[model samples]
Target chain A: MLKDMKELFKEQWEHHNLIFRMAKFEVKGMYQIHYLGSIWQFINPIIQVGIYFVVFGIGLRGGRPIDGDIPFLLWLLMGLIPWFFISPTMVQGSNSIYQKVNLVSKMNFPVSLLPTIRIVGNSFQFLALLVVLFIITLLYGIFPSVQLLQLPYYLLSMYMFLFAFTIWSSTIATLIRDYQNLLQSMMRMILYLSPILWDPMGDRVPDWLGNILKLNPFYYIIEGIRSSFLGGDWFFEDPIYLLYFWTLTFIMLYFGSRMHFRFRKDFVDYL
Target chain B: MAKVEFKNVSKVYDMYAKQSDKLLDLLSIRSKKSTKQFWALRDISFEVNDGETIGIVGLNGSGKSTISNILAQVIQPSSGEVTINGVTSLIAISAGLNNNLNGYENIDLKCMMHGLTVEEIEAVKPSIIDFADIGEHINQPVKNYSSGMRSRLGFAIAVHTDPDILIIDEALSVGDSTFANKCLLKMEEFKQQGKTIFFISHSAKQMKTFCDRVLWVHYGRLKNFGAKKRVLGNYVEFTEWFDQLSEEEKKKYKQNMLRKQYTVQEKTKRKQADKKNKWTAFGHLAMFIPLLVLGALIVLGY
Candidate 1:
């Protein structure tokens, strides 16, 4: 299992150029038919944030601030930005292998890079949204401080978690397409379950229940991103969650790679 | 040096009644199911030296494409082994071109996937375009191109990559005679450069003109692999004879061959399975134990 993971890592390292080039093309290809081309990448997410802001911040929360002085829109945007990246990436990355297998089957290309390509492709939009979030934070008078340096750490954490989940999910989805549908519904459930729309750290939710929900690795990411921007505890302060997240990610990576290498040559047969 | 060798290589494709059964079989959760195995290639062995252009001639359903796919490393053999010494590129009809991408983008995409640097791709880009000869259609999406144009671009890209082993699987059948002749000249140049090529085509006369040897496959088995004249002569005569048989007789002949392909390996496979049963039980435990522990951890709030 370790050997398989190492082999996949080596292949990814060797073909990193191909992965990046294909990712760039993927982002370009996404909106090639639209009149605005790539500009929709920004517009679509902003529209989603607007909808959630109205529904959750105004309609539900009475346009009130989250926690103390953090306006609901700013707080929601922080969590939703990463959620927007994570959600579509979950669907697209899971489908990447099944979609590209036929196109690349005749070549000697590394199949493991397909999921990575999706993850990286989706990151372009995620990074753009992060820039918007930063400028919004300044507009709201939240000055850049030492807490902002942790943004990179949280960003890396998000990528690692996405990589692990996508690799594993893509393998299962390719083998059993029903899993893809199941994953779609599960992402919807996760959106509600995570502290994205509502505050699990608020007064209404029970402490034990909130702790249970925090067990989700995505909670670590959504919360980590919010905390980095909103000035909360560092990731290291939550040692148990940090340990749990890394453990889960590595386990997924190990198994994902094992299954990936075992069935790569047979992927064409399946399709 | 022998650039390609196959030692008793065979490929078995299992026909699963339900897709879920495939997942179960992959995970070894189910010991056996009512699976039907189709042996595409059975115990076939051959070797090719550098610079040798071997023609693969077989009737439809004789597993000709299966052999080419295995040779190109697109699929793995079910048993035995194959050794390929250098980079391989396969050019089937419209193989590996993204339909949504334009012709020029397909060139860069394929070349990049083959590990060429950007500068290298740029250097070869013009020649590939010139050779494809699709003109202004190069800017149009590949989906809009005709089959002939698609194959033209496919052949152009495959040759430009300059693989050490090239397998052409009926890619020439879809192109115009002029383009086919152009490909043949380029293949002749490759032969002079000591590259091994596997040519699979129905045109016996072309095979005779170009190939150093011919491999005649009959229903997944190697009927003969020898000098060009001898094997092609035998194959041409066999096809002529088979073509003259009554329709019923032809049906009977095919049924008999396919039955043999299915049943020949059953006894050996069973014996091997019996031997494997013991280790498989232990293997199940090894996998199950870790999964059980992992489940416990997840349930315990990680």
Candidate 2:
């Protein structure tokens, strides 16, 4: 059943320059037109956190401690940063092929790179959010630590995780369009399920349910971020979750890419 | 000497009478004969020597553009092999230009697509801008440019890349006569450089002036491909005859083209089917080994 994916990788290698340029173009073109331009990168996420805070932090929890000792805003912001990064990143990453049908069909560039372009595009925006996240943490009196370097390690993990997910989501979303809507609804559900707004690890959430929430591969990312930011634990401290996340991600990525190779030629017709 | 060759290259689009047939096809449950097929091209075989200029002439939906697309490697042929010897570029109105990007950015984008390095793109940028001749508007978004200006930019970027085989599909139709002539002069320079040029156009005069040979396609079949005078002469005669046909006769003419066209050639069908099955059956797991390889690499620090 196995084809020479080494060949597929070589093909991707050949188009690395194209992917890099397209990703760079996407990152630049996104914020170039507006008056606030690059400033919106900072404003958009802050406002998103504000709305979540008003609704969940203040409205629901009355702006109190969320984790055992962490304030609601700190907990919420750490969770929300990844949430914001992932929600649109997946949504847009899934739709990247449908949106750039012209480029995929008409140009000589690699169609597989479409998902990567989206992932990279969102990563740049996430970079901005990352800087803001650190700033807010610093303001709250958490001094920088040796563990701060873990941010890049987690960033690489998020990229690997999302890029892998995107390989599947973008390709599958093209074949079965309902996957996009399904994902949209699922993202909403994921928000509730993944401890974005609530204390899934706290006593309010049952121990069994909280343990189950950790099963979500997406939780792997947010938990990694929180662990790094809070200096609670190293990524390898939880080896089972790491293994589970990698297995789930690579399998989805494998299937996602298979769909890409099989259907890439037919995409223009489908569009 | 064969810069490009198509040996029995055919493209058959699976025409689903009902949209749900696509799903059935996916499940491999649909009977072979139950699915209607529309062949965009059939048994197309030709070879273009280095520096040869070939013109493609056909009515709308007659597969002229399809030929250009296949040769440019934009799409794969359904069955048979396409051997292209060198870098190919296709120029058409808005073929690959991103609407959101400015003209200047589009040059870099297109050049990058051609796999040029940063220094290479920098070296060619000035020439492309000069060739396009769109002044201050170059800084503005391409979506704001008119159709004529878009073609100018597309043509400029394509020709500047020094492609070994250049295919132009109806892009010149939009530009003004002066710009079209300017393009022709540039193409002549490419011809002198021993590059293969495929020109697809409705203009007989343009074909006569630019093309050394002509290929006439009719209803997805190659009617004739030879010296421009020999093929264009017959194609002109056929169109003239068609124009004079009475309304009743025209309907019969179309019917005649479709008659005896559905007989499935087992060889081409089997090849396409085998390819489809191979990819669908194990295509996912095909990458299983690669994933394991990547997994191993990731577990390692680097």
Candidate 3:
């Protein structure tokens, strides 16, 4: 069994490029169905930003200020940018196996690659959103700083985090169909729990709750992006947080991979 | 040298009748219980060496699909082991290819699914396109294509994979006679190239022409497996005899067989089926209960 797992990993590694390309193909295939094509990727997120700004920034102006410096709209956009990256990737990633049940059953190939494809496909859309974010931020006078040089590192960390979580969700969701619904609810809860809309640092929450908030990987990731893009600080300055994020990412990846490898052969039977 | 093996394999499928039955069961509105367990295939064992073509001949629900599915690894056997030497491609033909994807993309995706690298897929793409011969329709989604076009594309993709073992389940029946002949020729070429092939069809003549060996599965058991001529000859005789039986004779035979196999529950089920007005009672209750309550309220109106 162990030997089989090792062989599976080796096969997955060798086929990683094919997996990535197929993932890109799946995204492209989605675009092929629509009249507007690739323009939707750019347009969708901007539309999301506009709707949220109107609803939350203007409509439900609850008089809650963000750090007393940043505009509420800007803060919401910053928060939403990461939330966009995380939510869809995780949700779609979780359901990918079930969605492609027929393909997995009929074909003999690496099954782990299916869920990973969801993450990679979503990453393309996320990149489009990033370009839109950059242009919007630039217009708002939130110019690039020296800390902007660490953007690549933050992006890498976020990708790693997304990949890890996707693997975890996809594997578990295969056995328990309800995990997809559970994940959506959890994401909604976490969206409010994390420092996405509110400033964790500025809030006078209890220290115990504050400490718990720091433990969420999204808190670090969203905060990491906010620091680099908004507050202008290098990501690597806090080695402890970086270590925590990487360690958690690796743990999720390891277990997720192990579950996938263990269950893949029997997947068709269940499907 | 054995390319495929099925040893004492059995698959039992638990079939639930429908949601209506379940709802009746939940509401204690039972007519006759409709759920049952069925053994699709049982104690099936066979072996085929490399470079041999074997054909499975059976009627519908005779476990032909179940055997093919097990060989394809699409579903696991309830018991026993199936061992194969190299990559096996089981093209149910109708089941695998996506109708939403265009022929070109379907080819690409199928190639990727079979573990072909992108460059390798690109190298073979032209030949596959040429073989499919649907011309400009290859660029359109497969849903728009005729069933013959779908078969052509499916056959093209399956052959291009260069499988060590090829399993075809009712694929050749779809295309026109010309395309079917072309497909048979391709299979002959693959057979000559020393690949193992399992062909499933209801046509006895086709099996006699194509296969070195014939396997007859009767109600999930291996009824016959040997040289094609002898096995098929016996199968043809048996089926002919079955067809010639008189209605009364067939009815008597069926009753005798059922009597031998039926359980006490089955007997009770038959009795219940004769006695029940379950649906009518439930329907009347559903229609009259509201009216009855309304009439009572009107009589006691405040």
What's candidate 1's DockQ score? 0.41
Candidate 1 lDDT over residue span B1-302, tens digit each: 57899999998987677777778877766556356778889999998898899999999989999999999888889998899999999899856687767888888888888878899999999999999999999998888999899989989998999799999999998988999999999999999998999999999998999999999999999999999999999999999999999999999999999986774223123334565777856664575455445444544545
Among these predictions, the greatest DockQ belongs to: 1
Backbone clashes, candidate 1: 0
Docking class of 2: acceptable
- Candidate number with the higher DockQ (2 or 3): 2
Worst 10 residues of 2 chain B by lDDT: B262-271
User: Residue-wise lDDT of candidate 3 within B17-94, one digit each (tens)?
Assistant: 664553454344677744464667878898999899999997666789888888888788877888978888887767
Please give each candidate's TM-score.
0.92, 0.90, 0.81
Q: For model 1 chain A, give the 10-residue run with minimal summed lDDT.
A: A25-34
**Candidate 1: tens digits of C-alpha lDDT, residues A1-271:** 2898889889889888899998887776567657898899888888988899889999999998987799998888888889989999989999999998876766768888999999989888888888999999999999776777788998898888888788888888888889999999999999999989999889998777777787677888888888888778888986666767777777788778878888787887877
Shift of residue A90 alpha carbon in model 2, Å: 1.6
Interface RMSD of each: 4.1, 7.8, 20.4
RMSD of each: 3.5, 4.8, 13.1
Number of clashing residue pairs, candidate 3: 0
The CAPRI quality class of candidate 1 comes to acceptable
